[model samples]
Target: MALPKPGTPVRGSTTGRPIMALLDLLGRRWVLRILWELREETLTFRELRERCDAMSPTVLNQRLRELREADIVVLEEPYGYALSKQGRQLLEALMPLQRWSEQWQKKLAAKADQES
Candidate 1:
């Protein structure tokens, strides 16, 4: 599927809200892992593939293309691929979600313990 662009209809939505578009893109497999791998350092194509073990180069290529189209990732030749400014901001935006997931994990563990 094409990278969901703002103002364009995306999966599960007709209104084309930016949030929905974002979700559609991020919902794709390996997209988040790519972002996370590039969070701290720029990596070459091979390096990125190594970081995301088991991810086929074909899929990575496609995801990178989509991310670049979305302005989330950029090619910084000599060094390799890196997150664009907006990509960094997007990662920052996801921090809250990470915290929530951690909290949710703890809650689930507690519930499991209670049932034990």
Candidate 2:
């Protein structure tokens, strides 16, 4: 089924703010991972599945469908699946978040070491 657009109620969101909609979609299992995996190259369904450590085909297909609907990914001839321009832009936008996560990981590790 097609997902509701921004400004309409979506899962966990009654206000339907666009950011909430985006977060709801991204929060689904494997969604962010799928996008991250596609950052560099196009991959066939099987390749993507393998890269995702053999995620269930059913879930992968579902996530791909949702991404396509969101205009973040596309299926192409000969190339299988690749990120669309919008997807690339989104990934680029996420670079800062990626950097932040690396720092956050280090901080957590340090805290864990101190506690231990």
Candidate 3:
């Protein structure tokens, strides 16, 4: 399905602001995980499913279709599946967030230890 355009209603935002629409799409279960798994190399459907801890094939296929439609992923002649240029750029933008998540994970662990 074509993604909802900006200014159209999205999952959480009636205004469908671009950012909100993006968040809505990215927030879907396994979406980010799929993107992360594809960061280093193209993987076939089976490989991706295995990497994703055997996520149901149906869900994986659905997410893949959506990503392809969004121009965030493409299937190469023999490369299986890889991120498109826009997808790579988006991953680059998310790098800082990934770094922050590592630190946040540490902080959470420390807090849990203190409580324990």
Q: For each candidate in the order shown, give its overall lDDT on alpha carbons.
A: 0.94, 0.91, 0.92
- The candidate maximizing TM-score is 1
Ranking by lDDT: 1, 3, 2
RMSD of each: 1.0, 1.4, 1.5
Model 2: number of clashes?
0
Which ranges in model 3 have alpha carbons more than 4 Å from their true place? none
Estimate TM-scores for all models: 0.94, 0.91, 0.91
Give the local distance difference test score of model 3: 0.92
Give the Å shift of residue 5 in candidate 2.
2.1
In model 3, pairs of residues that clash are none
Candidate closer to the true structure by lDDT (higher is better), 1 or 2 = 1
By the lDDT metric, which is better: model 2 or model 3? 3
- Candidate 1, RMSD to the unseen true structure: 1.0
Poorest lDDT segment (10 consecutive residues) of candidate 3: 1-10
Any idea what lDDT model 2 has?
A: 0.91
What is the number of backbone collisions in each predicted candidate, taken in the order shown?
A: 0, 0, 0
